[model samples]
Structure formats: C-alpha cells, structure tokens
Target: MSQPQAGRGTFITFEGIDGSGKSTQARLLAEHLRAQGHDVILTREPGGSPGAEEIRALVLQGDPDRWSAETEILLFTAARRDHLERTINPALAVGKIVVCDRFADSTRMYQGLSRGDLRATVDQLHSLMIGREPDLTVLIDMDPDTGHARAKSRQTAEERFEDFGANLQAQMRAGFLSLAQEFPERFRIIDGARAIDSVATDVAQTVSTHLSSVG
Candidate 1:
C-alpha cells in the first residue's frame, strides 16, 4: 500500500457540494496517479489533520443555536490552517502530489453564502491565511436537492449543514458557477449531474491534460 514517490508533483483539490461526488472523484484521480508511479497523497478538508477532525465533528454535529456565524467561520479557518501545516504543505514540500477533497474554496462558497459581502472576505482570508491556493480547483456543480437526496441515501440522519436550507444551497450553486467564470484559469467546471462514470471521465481527461501541460 505504499505510493510511488515522484521527484516533484502537483497539488490538486476537488470542491463541490455534498453528494456532488467530489470525494469519490478525488480518490479516483489519486489512484490513477498512484498507479502511474507518482507520489500521491489524498486527504479531505475540515478534518484532514488530527486537530481538525475534532473541529470537524463539532461543525457537523449541528448545535446551530450554540454556534454563532463568526464562530463557525473561525472554526473552519482554524481547521484549514491545521490542515495546511500538518498535511498539505508538508506533502507539497516533499514533492508529493496532494489531491485534497476540499479546500479554501469551500469557505468562499459556504461562509460567503451564509454571510453577506463575500467578495471582501475571500480576499482578506486568502491574504491572511491560505498563503498558497490550489493550482487547480475542480468544481463539481450540482443541484442541492439532487445532491442532498443522494447524500441522504447513503446516511441515516443528516447533520450539520445538511439543513442549510434551499436558498443558501441555491446560492452555493450560483456561487460556484460565478467562481468558475471569474477564475476560469484556476477552475475546471464539471457537470456533476452526469453519471458517475461520465463525471470521472471528464475529470480524468482534464487532469491528464493539465498534468501534461504542467509537466
């Protein structure tokens, strides 16, 4: 179960709403890369590091009334900071390709939708914390209703943001599209509504081409 170690590798992150298959596709890409004799490290956000996992539980546990808007934002950022130091940056330093399930972009989507004046917050946070952003962000766009349905099918009880309401989710869908448009060079927009295989194919092709270009 040891992954091959390449001389130098890239950092890739998959971002999307729950059930958009970001995690599944992220793993597939890492497996493909690993099979190709590349150094690949796969991890997920809000819980990648040990400290972050504790925060992740609280975030997902749904003490909505107890957790304030600002508290939620800080907790998320705190998790990301830990994730960066404990996993992401270290892997990148070792020339290992880090294929992360989610990253800072989720903050922009989630906190942005939850709070107002998102544009300003994103810039400040980027400059203050996430020193380096993902070279490529694969955004799987999907409807919240459909995604929630699929996510629920696999789980018994929905927790945390599962109750984020239709309006907030609708904003997330639009926000992701707008983000892709605004940062086309950094984002690969994939239609997550497609069949699993179809979406995987699209992502593989895109990542392959990108790797070739960067290589």
Candidate 2:
C-alpha cells in the first residue's frame, strides 16, 4: 500500500460482515486515540457527509432487491466519492486520525463479489473516482450464524444487507478473509468472536503497533 503524503493524517477503517462488532470497535478505537491526546474523527461509509448520508439511506434501507447489483455498486461509489471529498480528505489534510467504520472494502465484498462478479467494475470505478485506501484496515472476523443473529436482533431499517440471509453472511465472512490476504500490508485480522473487551484489546494493540511503526 502507498504511504499517506507527508503531513497527512492516518486513515483507519474497520470491516466485517454485519454485526461483527466493527462499528463498535471503530468507535472504541477513536475514543481510545482521543483519550491518548491524538486528534481523531470517527465516521462511517455510505454516510460520512450529508450527501453521502442521503445515499446511505437509499442503499441501506428498502427491500433486498430494491437495487440491482450494478446499481448498488454505482450508489456506493457515489457515496464514497462524496465522503472522500467532503469528509475524509479534508480531515486527513489537517492531520487528524480518521477512524472509519467501513470503507471501500465493504463494497468490494457486498457489491463487487457477492451480488455478482463485478469486482473489476468496482476497481475501475474506484481508481477513476476515489483512489484512496485506508492506511490500516481492521477486519473483525466472526462466525456467520452469530453475526447474522446479532444483526437481526437489532431490527433496524438498515437491515437490507442482513436480510440476505445467513448464507450471504457466510459468504461475506469468507470474502473478507480473502480480502485481508489480498491486502496484507494494510489489513489486520482480529477475532471478533471473543468478549467485546477482549476483541477491543486486540484491536487496540494491533493499531498501536501500526501507529508506532508508521511513526
């Protein structure tokens, strides 16, 4: 992975199947960094900026078949472009550590691989519009059944993806692990099946090592 430009802030993203606890981990990491006197911004994809948030509602709610795989990819890419322009890049330019709940990698799995074999289209669009990748990505690996149950228990309108069923969750879990291998330089795998505190400890340690090495 390419290093961030000099004077740029670190970009850290969390990724996993729904209910894998990535969002919680992202929040905790942001808080941890802030308490340690580091400037941090906690955000999430599909909805970091106002415009992107609007798009987020479109893609995250509604029936599972509301949008075609191709359309979903376009929607996600648009949101990401807006997010980078309005939120992520500005923060990084100012040297604030940005902790994001999910990034392009989620799209890679959900829209690119899962919906169909559109990974190439996803990559092409990504390179042309938004070319940034996270400095570090934490993958919270979890069992599909457990993650699916947790996601359903929430009963949120954004359960569109979770509505795909446990099979998709299993597929997503496998896809994420494969993605980690594909980007070993910036990806860290954390076992999310453990207690919340234990998982957070592992995440914290992993990020601390990354920060120290980069510094």
Look at candidate 1 and give me any clashing residue pairs.
none
Top candidate on lDDT is: 2
Q: lDDT values of the candidates?
A: 0.79, 0.93
In terms of TM-score, which candidate is strongest?
A: 2
- After best superposition, candidate 2 residue 29: deviation in angstroms? 0.5
Residue 71, candidate 1: Cα error in Å is 1.4
TM-score of each: 0.89, 0.96
- Candidate 2: residue 192 lDDT (0-100): 95
Model 1 weakest lDDT span, ten residues long = 1-10
Q: How close is candidate 1 to the true structure, as a TM-score?
A: 0.89
lDDT of 2 at 165: 99
Q: Candidate 2's residue-wise lDDT over 1-215, tens digit each?
A: 33223338999999999989999999999989999999999999889999999999999999999999999999999898888888898899999999999999999999999999999999998887888799999999999999999999999889999999999999999999999999999999999999999999999999999999988
- Per-residue lDDT over 1-215 for candidate 1, one digit per residue giving the tens place of the 0 to 100 score: 22222224588989887778899999988888888898899998888999998888887775445576556678888888888878887788778889999887788777755565565666576557666678889999899888776665675343566566556666777887888898888899899898888998899899988989998
Residue ranges of candidate 2 with Cα displaced over 4 Å: 1-7
RMSD of each: 4.8, 2.6
The CA-based lDDT of model 1 is what? Answer: 0.79
The reply for model 1, stretches above 4 Å from the true place, is 1-8, 156-158
